[model samples]
Target: MIAISDPIRIEPWNFAPERSNFPTRNLPNRRAEIAREKQLTTLIRENNRSRRTCASKIAEMAKKAGIEVKPLEIEFIAARAGIAIS
Candidate 1:
């Protein structure tokens, strides 16, 4: 009897173009650059809010990880801690 074999398959990944083959992105205009910088500065400036109370242990852990975390509402705290579940 003839042997049964799987048919050949075409994987799109094998034919994908390399990123280096694309042209480099153009730099943003001065106005856009200034806006982006300003937005980033605002985000960093408003990052800390000492409203909710965080656990001492959790705060210490965050500090050791180079992240200054203040306890938010329990919901927010749970969300943040969920990120470290792994």
Candidate 2:
């Protein structure tokens, strides 16, 4: 529950399989972005997929299609679609 200017991901504890420690909780004064983040996280949990997994899949698929997508861009696209792609 802390404010962070940039996104900081926290891994789930070994003992807590159902939770993760996300450091970036909110923006300075952007409620909309915060809400979207919350929603996106929820969607990720529901899908039972990790950010890395989604990003890798995206990259691989794009590469196969000769799109040459970058990691950062892939992650951003996944996030917008409610995917937890790092």
Candidate 3:
């Protein structure tokens, strides 16, 4: 018989790379960019409707599979669906 004491051990590594020296491009006009952002927001909202439906289906499937789902997981799914949970 083997006694299991520690489940796992972790070691930290410092692997950060130095920043690049590439020159950035000039951004577009603020007003035009704002308009584009609004359009993107609308598109994201519309897409999230379908995503929410998918999330609900996934939750149902998880329940059927006997997997325990936490409220935080549900909230994360809701956030991805663009549905605010507060």
Candidate 4:
């Protein structure tokens, strides 16, 4: 009869999942909102300047043509010209 061989043994160990101690906040979304607001503000300012320039040009043209035009009338006409303020 042949001699019997010993069987291999395996070791067992305890494993635990990792945990975090700090809470997370949605900071990136807030930053994006603030950035969009700033961009809109800048666009409004630029649009206002452009509107004023266009109004001034119209007033100058009317004046050179010897036509009577009031400042309030020019302002009203310019206000009717819509700008993409968004």
For model 3 the local lDDT of residue 10 reads 60
Models 1 onward score TM values of: 0.25, 0.33, 0.28, 0.30
List model 3 lDDT by residue over 1-86, tens digit each: 76688577664343323222321322344455556445434433444554544544544555565644544565464565466434
Q: Clashes per prediction?
A: 0, 1, 0, 0
Task: State the TM-score for model 3.
Answer: 0.28
lDDT of 1 at 5: 91
Candidate 1 local lDDT, 1-86, one digit each (tens): 75569677776643544322333432345455556445433333233244332344444555565755553422344453342211
Candidate 2 vs candidate 3, TM-score winner: 2
What lDDT is obtained when candidate 4 is compared to the true structure?
0.47
Q: Report the Cα RMSD per candidate.
A: 12.5, 15.3, 13.7, 23.8
Best model per TM-score:
2
Following a full C-alpha superposition, what root-mean-square deviation does model 1 have from the true structure?
12.5
- Judged by whole-model lDDT over C-alpha atoms, candidate 1 comes out at 0.42
Candidates 3 and 4, the one with greater TM-score: 4
Q: Taking the tens digit of each residue's C-alpha lDDT, what string does model 4 give over 8-41? A: 6664342222322221343565576556445433
Number of the top lDDT candidate: 2
Candidate 4: where are CA atoms >4 Å away? 1-24, 50-86
Candidate 1 ranges beyond 4 A from true positions: 1-28, 49-86
